[model samples]
Target chain A: MTDKTPHDWLNEHGDYLYRFALARLRDTHLAEDAVQETLLAAIKSPSFEGKSAPRTWLTGILKHKIIDIIRKQGVEQPAEDMSQYAAEEDPADEFFNERGHWADRPLAWPAAENALEQKQFLSVLQRCIERLPPKLARLFLLREVHEEDNESICKELQISPTNAWVMLYRARMGLRQCLELHWLGK
Target chain B: MLSCKQASELLSQSLDRPLTRRERWALRLHLWICAACRRFGRQLMLIRLAVGKVVAETEQNENLRLSPEARLRMTRALESGQ
Candidate 1:
């Protein structure tokens, strides 16, 4: 099999690469730059041995670029003030009663597997993720999207392990409510 | 008996870390009696599965893309680098 030229790579995989980066970086310029950088590196390296699909190979490179940028941002940006997060009201209070029982008990989501296959459901999920508080969203993405472990995430966000767990719990709780309200309940 | 709030929090934390024997037993006991908490646990798992699916299939999503100008700029950069 012959190798495709750089233009061919761009034409075929450009948007996919851009979307992947944007999901992680959430900054348009950074996402675009990451896609470009990945393509350039792919062009320079002779590492494509045709074991995986072109898109998969490109994504591998893009993942590293994203991680590097996140690391840099961790250093450049001030540490997150986690005290404010700690002081924030428990999200569970909205769903639980004074007795700590579920006020609005969770209903079983019918056909949840089918919802995953639908494009509309996916978009709703994306919007819910975007609605998450910025720090919570970052922690969620680092764990769910980037597949980073809790230790590294704590280090990257300058949050303690306990705080990371609390933040992640908040993020999941928020996302669950948003999904139920917007998609499942409808 | 674990309250619904504590049980649910333990359920969420189980996704990130292993629960101790006592915590696991308490959660199990609560889930056995609490239908709502059981549903909550399943829904949390579904949310995680949905997020993974979104990441896996992002390439097929037409709503998200690089703008034309950015694409053009990247193309130029690639050409120059070549």
Candidate 2:
């Protein structure tokens, strides 16, 4: 394969890299900075022997860049208020009755098959993710989107293992309900 | 019998880690008897699958892109670094 110039790299991989960062950072400026830094680092590194696809190599660099930003931001930002999560009134209460049975039975989603191939379905999913409470969205994205392990997520968020589990459960519950309402038409 | 609330939490937790044998049995039993909880579990699994697809497609998604200004700024930065 022939060598591509910096301009070529920017034209090809810029948006993909930017979106990858934006999903994790949730800040447009931070995502832009990350993509810029990743590209710059890729340009400077001597290790690109052209063995792997350029996008894959660049994504490898971008992943580390994202981790660094998450670590740095973790220190700079104050701990998120988790008291609401610890309250006695569980969010799950909305779905369960006094007997702990489903207050509203979940309807089977017949449309779920091949839904991923539909752009509209994906956009609805994205909207549901955006609608999530900020803390829940972050935790969900870290675990599901970035594929971070539970231990590392708890450490990064300064939450205990139990809290992490509870938070993740809440996130999934929220997303499931959102999809059911909007996409499943329930 | 595990309540639907408890069983649902276990279903979500099972995504992240291995469940204890007792927890697994309780969940299985609940799922066996509870159609609603079974539907919930299936939907949760579908959501996970959908999320994986969404992440993969975000790269090629036309709606999500770097602004032209950001792209130009990145280009200038790259050029100066050379």
Candidate 3:
């Protein structure tokens, strides 16, 4: 690795690391702190011989930093009233009729296996996630992205098993509606 | 007869935890007859896949750069570590 100064690392990889951190951490200040920690770690490590892309190396460090924070913090109590997101109650009723049948069937999506590779689709998905209420969004990510099980999520969030299930279900339902509108509708 | 709502909840739950025999049977029956619920289940899986991809690709993305102020703060922190 070239003897690049800290400024060089910042200029080259700071923002990318920040976005990566922010996407998972979901807190602006914490994201900044994680990026700061990543940069500091990079400086200490002597073996970053440019074997991989600079951004890739920095991201690897940032992933660890984010995990460290999540571990140290344990379960973060939702910073706000989670009930507001939950208070609306599940709109499960709308999907069914009096006899508990599909009042409105879910619209069919094109069988595009490559949709996941499309940048636009991801961008739309990102927007949909961002639009979710914070606690719900975090729970969704923890479950789907982090692969945390229901018990751990319930334990960490200090919610009951039922609450955890409801929140996750709502998040999926919400994401489905959002994608139907933004990505598929496009 | 599980409502689409019930089936949807069960479907989402199955991703997190193992479904019971009753749930599995109920969901299978519901999906077999309800095309809309079936579509929802498929779309839910697609969304999960897409999110995983987005999260993975974000790590290596270069299009987004840090702001000047933040870059400076992060840089100083690293230099101070040295």
Candidate 4:
């Protein structure tokens, strides 16, 4: 490959690699570092076999770089307790009576098919997710974004299966409520 | 009888883990009569689908790019073998 190949990689794959790292690491600085390390490693390697797509190969390297960071970080801080999120306190109460019937039924949302196509919907969704408490947000993403299984999520966050379940429930409830108030209002 | 609260928790838990036969039966029975819980269940599914789409869009969007400083630093490191 020519000298321009590295520059080409930088131009083409930089943002993609950065986002992959960010999603795994969730720290902008660490994500940037991992991207740099992956590109540097790719450049230093003896040959490019072109066996897999270049982006895939780069991502594979980036994944390892992220794993190293996770390992070095060792035990993550315990996920925030579910009680800290206000939504957990009485989420059911708002919608259900003491007898557990619907006291205040959820409003009918606009057709989700139409809503998904709106570009603003995602921004609203993202902001709602950001509003979640830090640990809840992480757990939500671990399941939804990373598609990690429950066991891995518990192991990574140092929480029990029960805690994981409660937190996830809270996160989902919180997001749905936030969307209703902020985004889905007609 | 499973109230809406209990039934809703069952629905959310079903997404994370399988429901027990008893829990499934209870939730089913409650949902049968409660139009509100039924609507909530459908909304939950929509939230799951929409979240998946937003995450895909997030991965592809240009908004998450590295800063110029980081990009330049990475480029220089690659070029110089440092």
Candidate 5:
């Protein structure tokens, strides 16, 4: 019980710690609040033993805070609809593509990594991404994009392994067609 | 005589790579003559490529952030707690 715990280390590393939380939570007030809670919990439990980088320790706390923020936001911005992103509230079908393929023809582009460097590239991708269903976008973000494995994505997205596969398939299909149309201009 | 769903399921596999030799022959034969399936295959390929690009783009941006403020806030919280 001789450990300094989270609160004891705070005065020495306050600004540094807040920076970590702010990066994830994206709000000044919330970041402050999350740190406050993490400190209170660490002091009460006395489990914040001295070991790894204190910054890392705080970051772990902030990560939980970030997750809380995301969950409280009620829903991750459903990846499907760009319109919804603007309005921030919209009811839409999970899989609304009636067609057998992507709505937009794929746009030819420089390699994706190359395309990302340019701001204009995202614009061409807008419609095609909009075509993806919410779950599909989330899956795409988690899987191919994030390099997350099937198990982790399924757990976070609350989807079955089978559904995860389908969403990925759908995501790929949607993006491919959209890119082709843009790139080929057909 | 695969149903629409069955054919669709196989479509994903085909894009990754053609199905088994026997299945490929059947599918290839079907795609050769069937305009609808051919278009469908084309659509799927296009979609696949587009997603591949977008996914790459998303990852590159994933860890990036506007700045590092959380750590400072966490430190403040700790100070307050004491």
Candidate 6:
């Protein structure tokens, strides 16, 4: 319960913290600012009793800081346009095709593996990922690319363990289907 | 004893290695009879392996080519008074 306790927390956790912020914010300056504000707020809290790990505690503060930053930046979606990302496809049509299959019989694993080896495939993949919704894209980037664990991913995404699993599933499915349409010559 | 929905849930759960023995059994039984689930599993496998490979290549190239200034900044923040 010392005044400088949060300083120590930041010092210990800043790398993890910065990466978290940068990945979410996609801007170095903003992430740096978020980390600074998080440190300031965490130090002043009576709740900084170290009940949880310092990393977890600091990340919790950063999460809210991110939300506030996003809000102040007027990142809200128009209510009418909100469903654009949410309205992907008719689930019945997607999961169950007219011919009664997953609809797109995906190419072989090695075909995609070969795609991975090529520079052009990567360019294509990046383009597709950029088009992903922020939440879903972040989740996909973390879980699939960054190799984050289910527990860490769930906490970061602020979802139920089950919901995290579901979201991760969708992220994988969406990214693949999108990339397939874009690159795999479906 | 698992329903089709539960069996479907087990499909991903099994992939994650967190399924109970009973759930695993139910999923296996379902996949044995349901070509749909089998195809679904293949899709998941292909997608995962493909994505994993893509991640490896991109990760190698991305951090390697970070602008020197951005690299300096991240490095400095990491080393500062910690």
Tens-digit per-residue lDDT, B15-68, candidate 1 = 888899999999999999999999999888888888877766664668988899
Score residue B66 of candidate 5 by CA lDDT.
24
Clashes of each: 0, 0, 1, 0, 45, 0
DockQ of 4: 0.57
Q: Please tell me which predicted candidate would have the highest DockQ against the true structure.
A: 2
- Accuracy of chain B in candidate 4 (TM-score): 0.82
TM-score order of candidates, best first? Answer: 2, 1, 4, 3, 6, 5
In candidate 1, which residue ranges exceed 4 Å CA deviation?
A: A1-8, A40-54, A71-82, A85-88, A117-120, A146-149, A152-159, A184-186, B62-65, B76-82
DockQ, 0 to 1 scale, candidate 5: 0.18
Candidate 6 per-residue lDDT, tens place, A25-100, comes to 5556666777777776765677877455777778788877865555454432333233544475433346445544
lDDT of each: 0.79, 0.79, 0.75, 0.74, 0.51, 0.58
Q: Write model 4 residue lDDT over A1-186, tens digit each, in one string.
A: 344476778798889999877764667898898888888888777665553578888887876676566545542333444444445556556756888776767778777788788777777887888788754565676577555577765665556777667767778877888888888673
True contacts kept of 6: 0.13
Q: Give all candidate RMSDs, comma-separated.
A: 3.9, 3.5, 4.8, 4.3, 8.7, 7.7
What's the distance in Å from true for residue A88, model 3? 8.1
Q: TM-score of chain A for candidate 6?
A: 0.53
Cα deviation of A10 in candidate 1 (Å)? 3.2
Q: What is the lDDT, from 0 to 100, of the residue B80 in candidate 3?
A: 72
- Cα lDDT tens digits for candidate 6, B1-82: 4444444456665555477777777778877887656655666665566556554554233342333454455445544523
Residue pairs with backbone atoms closer than 3 Å in model 4 (clashes): none
TM-score of model 5 (first chain only): 0.48
When summed lDDT is taken over every stretch of 10 residues in candidate 6 chain A, the lowest stretch is A73-82
Candidate number that wins on lDDT, 1 or 6: 1
TM-scores of the candidates in the order shown: 0.77, 0.82, 0.72, 0.76, 0.43, 0.54
Tens digits of per-residue lDDT for model 4 on B30-68?
889988888888878877777778767767777899899
Error of 5 at A54 (Å): 2.2
